[model samples]
Target: METFLGIDYPTLWFLVVGGLFSGYAILDGFDFGAGAWHLFFKKEESRRIALNAVGPVWDGNEVWLVIGGGALFAGFPVMYASMFSAMYIPFILFLLFIILRAVSIEFRSKEEMLWWRKMWDISYSVSSIMLAFLLGVVLGNVLQGIPLGENFEYQGGPLLEFLNPYAIMVGLTTLALFMTHGAIYLLMKTEGRLFAKLTILVKRGIIFFVVIFGITTIYTLIYIPHLSDTFREDPVMFAVPLATFLCIANVPRLAMKHRYKLAFLFSALSMSFMLMLIAIELYPVLLISTIDPQYSITVYNAASSEKSLGIMLNIVAIGAPLVLAYTVFVYSTFKGKVKMDETSY
Candidate 1:
């Protein structure tokens, strides 16, 4: 049945994932850039200031991932059960890595001890590196499909499936994507040495990731066989990646001239489009299988009752705008450049 917008349940889920991924890219994108630049900010105070730029709102960005988890649990229990069970080891490790990053960010300031701060600093970067890899690998697994049995169980998993070449490529691609997003964040948020450092970082990252990502994407298409077919069959699906990379290329030149608002706008869009590409790639089917086509969880088959979706639609309609408004207000209030003296968590 059609909702108010004439969208069906399957299409509605794509919208929800789109919203969740968009929020993640906008909020977490800055964190990734700023965090990666942590090494470049030689001065302790400047590092703190760089961290402060995202302090008030970084946690809020993670809510999108939480929403993503909730969406999977509520909207597609089949994918939920299969993925969680198959990827339990890496999933648990991801939580630990994320917690370490959060703890280091919050408690680093509380401790004035040099050794303690340094220890936490390493903790932050290390955790970030591992966490980013895990996130990408998950995507890689999705693209490649795990060794699920005829019953949808990922029997050929654990270490073997996790380390497949396709998954490794996906991991690298995500690292590049997140770092690219982070670079743009740095270019827009800081001034003086910190800002310049970020610029260099951005230039290198953008050059590397944009190229690597493009190559990886092509490699994926060639290897996957059915990927281009999926895209040709659904025109909107193919456009997602093409549009995202284009924005990534265009935003920096505009930002260099202090056109930050525009840069931020495009950066947010770039990150969003990357996730949109992933969601669209997986459309109709939340999780497809190498084991069996029957195991694929399509939206219509996995979704909750029509009544449940209707209630969710109404709730999102009421609450989504307020959430968007609050995020915009926070970012705008803290707009312009941050200096070393101005650091807060």
Candidate 2:
């Protein structure tokens, strides 16, 4: 067993994969959140402003997803295969919605007809909402455990099984969180009436998210006791959830103070903290097997060869910094309110 800084290679790779997805959730999350609010703005100008808020960086934000997926496939091919096999339909729907969202954003303003723009607007909003929800559903199923049979294969079952109550609750919770995040982002990019409208929306979004999040938390505590085991064992681990709550609470506080930049930052931080909690809860186990404990795909069982992981880690060491630099540069270049020119989306 090779070690990097006293952590095993597989565990190190697990952290790497988690970090990439966390980055994706933080970056692309706002994009999805922004899109989720598309239809809320009635006027054409308002809609366009909202669209342009995320236009400059939405596609770039998706780069994290690509990198995260690739890292998962490379680092833990077995887990990737098993999870994908079990969640094929949901993943396909996710792909479809993601494509539709992209297409809607790109093509909405290309035509002059009102019907044309409306069609895309609906597509964009619905797609964004569905994308966020599906991601949560997948996470929920992963957290609960999948039916992985012998040889790490998915036990055959109806696709509708993925839509269990827990998964749906998680999905809605994810949607609410993203919507709140998006509203805060919109506040940063607009002024006057739009800003005023977004202020109200942000408040509503916060309430929506907090309510759903509270319910989801209660449900998890009541139904899925395993998720809290980590914290139960180590009292210190409670700090993560506490910090997450504080970060979430700070969003509305900063927004009320007209400090949207801080609000957005806190929203992103809250998301990161939430994912960190998930990572802590599920460390080492990539996917739990409902069929049998022994069949579960763990980091150790699912990871690639240590040599391969080592070489890839070296490559990631060089590549990740470059990606991060590029991301920072892009966001910095496009900072502040969106001013639409002829080329705007």
**How does each model score on TM-score?**
0.91, 0.98
Q: Pick the candidate with the highest TM-score.
A: 2
lDDT of 2 by residue, 219-314 (tens): 999999989999999999999999999999998899899899999999999999999999999887889988998999999999999999999999
Point out where model 1 deviates above 4 Å: 234-241, 255-260, 339-345
Model 2 TM-score? 0.98
Per-residue error for 55 in candidate 2, Å, reads 0.9
Worst lDDT 10-window in candidate 1: 336-345
Instruction: Note each model's CA RMSD in angstroms.
Output: 2.4, 0.9
Judged by whole-model lDDT over C-alpha atoms, candidate 2 comes out at: 0.92
lDDT tens digits, residue span 78-125, model 1: 678888887887899999988999999988988788999988888876
Instruction: Name model 2 segments beyond 4 Å from true.
Output: none
Q: Each candidate: what lDDT?
A: 0.74, 0.92
Q: Count backbone overlaps in model 1.
A: 1
Total backbone clashes of candidate 2, pairs 3 or more residues apart or in separate chains: 0
